[model samples]
Target: ASAKARLIDVFDLSDVQATYILDMPLRRLTKFSRIELEKESGELTTTIEELTAILDDDGNLRQVVSDELAAVGQQHATPRRTLLLEANASPAKSAVPLEVDDAPCIVLMSSTGLLARSADTEFDASADIARAAHDVIVSSVPATARGEIGLVTSAGRVLRLSVLDLPALPSVIGIPALSAGAPIGAFVDLPANEQALCLTTLDETGCIALATARGTVKRVVADTPGSKDSWEVIRLEDGDRVVGAVRLDDAAARTAELVLVTSDGQLLRFPATAVRPQGRAAGGMAGINLASGASVIAFGAFTPTDDAMLITIAGTTAALPGIDTGSMKVTPFAEYPAKGRATGGVRCHRFRSGEDLLTLAWVGNGPVRACSSSGVPVPLPTELGKRDATGVPVAAPVSHVAGSL
Candidate 1:
């Protein structure tokens, strides 16, 4: 006790161990007490060395904290209240910026409203060998998987479809080999009895040329922003409906001419500027003066240097069902004089026997490909000719024509 008192005075005994020693009971101060104090002092010295080593070594200090935390966690662990899944650990609704493949793809739409995507725009196969039973492939347009496609309806409405949303198809196989495609209604809402007329890609800034069966035409700005899935393109008369709609790029809208084809083989070519641009709801000006029974079947835009292909599908009547005997001929746009709007245009294709009606026409700057009902490629005229000539018969019955190939 005396030695401890002297030691406490000599050394600054401010530590916990020194305090306990200094406060020892007076009755336990015996020789045995001295032995006990020595043993405890030795033990305390060992503990001090271990703690000092732990403080000096960062790895050992970290281990001590980890072990203590683990012990506490094990003793107080609780079950999670929320369900967790390995497949969807993160609650992400969609990719940031929507990672869409920008590779080029071909958008195919059948007359029955089935839609599919293919990598090759020039893909060709027989209709019997390519398409499903009773399905007619009507339109195929080349677009990137990231581009927007416009599904123009006979009701004169436009439905926008993202190519990324379209089901991807095998490039080598025909349409019949794949599953029956989704309907147009799957992507856009449509009114009862409303059917799609054509599939076209939208331009960044341009106008949409719309032509109706009653010979009315309108040009609506293509870039008009809207949140709705579909938009009004033209106002139809009581008995008339939109037969065709095409998107004209800024270049095409400025310099291209509009070509309107009739069931009676009348072809009207006029500058796109001839008719002023109209609003979406405006009833359009006259594009052609249809005869009593004749109606417009196709409308397209082309530049003067571009060669246009007019396809006349032979049938008993001017309808898809009557498209049996078909002929496709290419004509230079310079050959056909640009007539005034609402005028009766000159003849573009002379009627072959059994084919007095024209089924479809396609106008663009690039090479055009015509196909039979079965999707097989039909040969186009090797030699370009003047306007208003009889077209050569296709190798098989033709049903559709695709331009800008």
Candidate 2:
């Protein structure tokens, strides 16, 4: 009735008994009599022939048993456990009980009042091994509960703080001319050698602020207060005029150049450099009426219907097909009207990548529709909403106002 039960499982075998069962000389077992086998039924016994047969198999039986017993010993070995205590408790009385299948050779409490176990009897309670085990357990705790673990290094740095413990990032800093109390709306970093000017309406006074690498501070316009629609023109070193007023949404640098949309839906570019006082009237175009007149200027590759013409000092002229400028023929120096829309006002137009112009027309109360330069309608993003100065969606409930800067 010899069964395959492990030799160690059958009796309270000591380490020596296990070793003898696996490593005893095979010649000793072959001489055992039937009476001895009956007396030690569960004991290790084998004949020379049995040993030879086991050896002849693909795998040796004794070797297999030895390997299995070694694995079992390791599996049943006393495991190190750690128990973290509250910060207010003292280690002498606050140490928690550690449940284990086998008793450890040594047990000690950590500086954080955590219970630690080890197999070596000479194990130091403050040794690196115990500390390492304690640290592993504490580090694996959730970030929210890590503060309760009360574990710190010699240098006073917390051990288990995770990313969740860190505070949220601060908003981008250093905005120009932004009042300390005013909330920031938009921001943009100007290119090197580029200056951004902002026009702000403070206390009903038109104030101008220049943003350079040096700093952002406001300067009084010193000019006459005109209509809110009054524009500023600046002349560039390249002999081009940047026409338009500037409005600052945040401390970010913004150019003074603005695009004005007239009642007739004509777009014009007024450079910031060419702005100057013109008689009693201080408006853009320097008193130059471009409605019936034609001016050639280099404009962006794509322009909305609001930007119909660019009034630059340079001899560069670009056409914006988004705005139905009434069959206006775009020439080198002038844009002449070719045909006019039958009805309804022109809608906002935008240029896609390259020279592709997209015009969005608000025809009646239906959905805003878009069309290509060739009179072909195009699809737009479904999430289209009122965008802020930086093209981000504006929160619900918006208000529009007019003022000069």
Candidate 3:
């Protein structure tokens, strides 16, 4: 009782006269009148509103304060004029030009030449010691029909060079020959396997020459009456005979499945076994272009061109489209135009791995471009020069006169 009295005292409940009215009977409560009840109800409502206001203030006190300040400012402020400012933004510019480093220049022909001129600023020096001297030879000389100037190092090592990093030296050495008097033109070094293949022209025979590191030379000749062009040595795999070569003027190999683009632009294929011994195109049966000696016996179409066919060493043929050299777009092979119209028939050469085919193409005024099996073009550095009918670069070393990497 004492505690309850204290709580009531603290809460100020002693002013309520309803305690005695509640203890009276229902009839006696009616005597208290509705006026008193209404007054009490109004007091209870005010108390609840005050409690709610306190709770609201505690929950978001800072927000409530800020909102209250904003409300007060808005209620008392006057409108002001607004001003707008516009600034132009420009696109970012490159710091240098893409073609600046591609300027033409003379390359050094030997390590001694490169090392001697290493400190000189006359020519941009490349770090490829192996190709330094070869690049110099290829760039300084003029193209001649006699034969592409063979690049031999002071150590008597042959260089398979690429024009990509001109003024660079060759890093590889020692390739074989396809035949006697066959001049090796260009070649690539298989660094991983320590072997190399050279593209060369046989003496006066117009035969395809391939030299290997094993001191072996293999030759494939298209002795047919109408075959006057040379063959480009595309790639070398397996052995001296297991190589791939492509005709520069046409997209066909020597032997395997014969894919011939006729003078009228009609494509045709013949199997090695089905080739007639004495009939038309006889004794001219397509033979394996390289030395690996793999046999080709099937025929298939690789393109829609009635004149283009894919000839495999196994005698299989695939039809492809004819290359419209005049209308084709000329871009770096790596940056082949994806949106350009189909200008040339596609020729595919399957590598030993058989995953993809290497596609060589002739486009408008541009050198033949080699595309990967997946259609990604392998950009041949301009220094390599343009390919000839045999798919080999013409004997012009001057075309390789490019600056530096």
Candidate 4:
């Protein structure tokens, strides 16, 4: 009664509430009801003590406020709507190029200008090509796996390719074969109707020699390494286009002979130095005067040491004697007197009765081997003979250059 009276006094209960409490039903004052009221009273007393304690210390009060705020935040939280990036994550104008270790590699280009790289210096001709049925290996070069390769197009432009950028192929049957590769047009923005003619490794120490179908030739200083932009290596006339490109050093240019073979079996050999080095954009000077219906088929720098072999399209192989380094006097096997530029070259091979043209010419110091278009080995006679001899025929036609990877 005293506790109830004190509560009513603290709450300022009116006379009507006091009367109601006095007139409470007897059922409302059961033992369970008394126990529930006692529990509620105890909870209220504990809450009052906690509130007093929190009010007594600033830290306790702040903690209570922080806890309430956290609870409210958790109940009302929503998912984020914007993403956050790193402080320096802005987009750039160009992508960074990749760096790789230098290793031996073979770069292959298809007839349709597709390009690929293999880790091996040699390819398995017997294995199936990693390209379409119509595509064939038109040009290839041995170079460092990470070196830069120059791609010459029929339009006389040179597009640069990093050997590392090419896809590497797996080795099968002891030789690596390019399984798949990107097209040259993807890396080079070639003009319409332009097609890739040849491929060569690029370096700063050498010069690039270009030969065109119309018998024009030019030697241009090689551009510095690491350039990705395509440049004009040779300027061509309306009807003329590049057919071949060779790398030559200053010393090699002085002694090495520039050999050009025509479709009619005519071969011209002259000092490479005869054609002075010109700028990349300069139109090349005449290299040979093509006969009325004859066209230049192949051009390369020939360093004669032991022999030069002429392989005809009809599969005839003839070995021509070269520099006789064995004798006390280094005598050439055949005296191909140096001629002025634009002169029709002397005969290199006498066409057989049925044979019409020559397809490949090789110059090396040691014995040479023949590889077929399908990667099989083709046998050749070991006999060394005089120049301008008729080539011995084989079973199949020689489609590409001998020893060209």
TM-score of every prediction relative to native? 0.59, 0.18, 0.17, 0.55
Order of the predicted models by lDDT, top scorer first? 1, 4, 3, 2
Candidate 1 lDDT at 266 equals: 82
Q: Return the clash pairs for model 1, or none.
A: 126-374, 127-374, 127-375
Off by over 4 Å in 4: 1-147, 169-195, 201-203, 224-228, 314-338, 354-386
lDDT of 1 by residue, 84-138 (tens): 2256576668746756669888887864566777777664443235233313455
Using lDDT as the measure, the top candidate is 1
List per-candidate RMSD values in Å: 25.2, 31.2, 28.9, 26.5
lDDT of each: 0.71, 0.26, 0.28, 0.64
After TM-score superposition, the amount by which residue 191's alpha carbon in candidate 2 deviates from its true location, in angstroms, is 38
Tell me the RMSD of model 4 versus the true structure. 26.5
TM-score order of candidates, top first: 1, 4, 2, 3
The reply for model 2, stretches above 4 Å from the true place, is 1-256, 277-405
Tens-digit lDDT string for candidate 2 (53-137): 8778756877878999999999997433222335676647536564323322222222122322233333122322211211211
Q: Highest TM-score, which number?
A: 1
Kindly indicate the candidate among 2 and 3 with the higher TM-score.
2
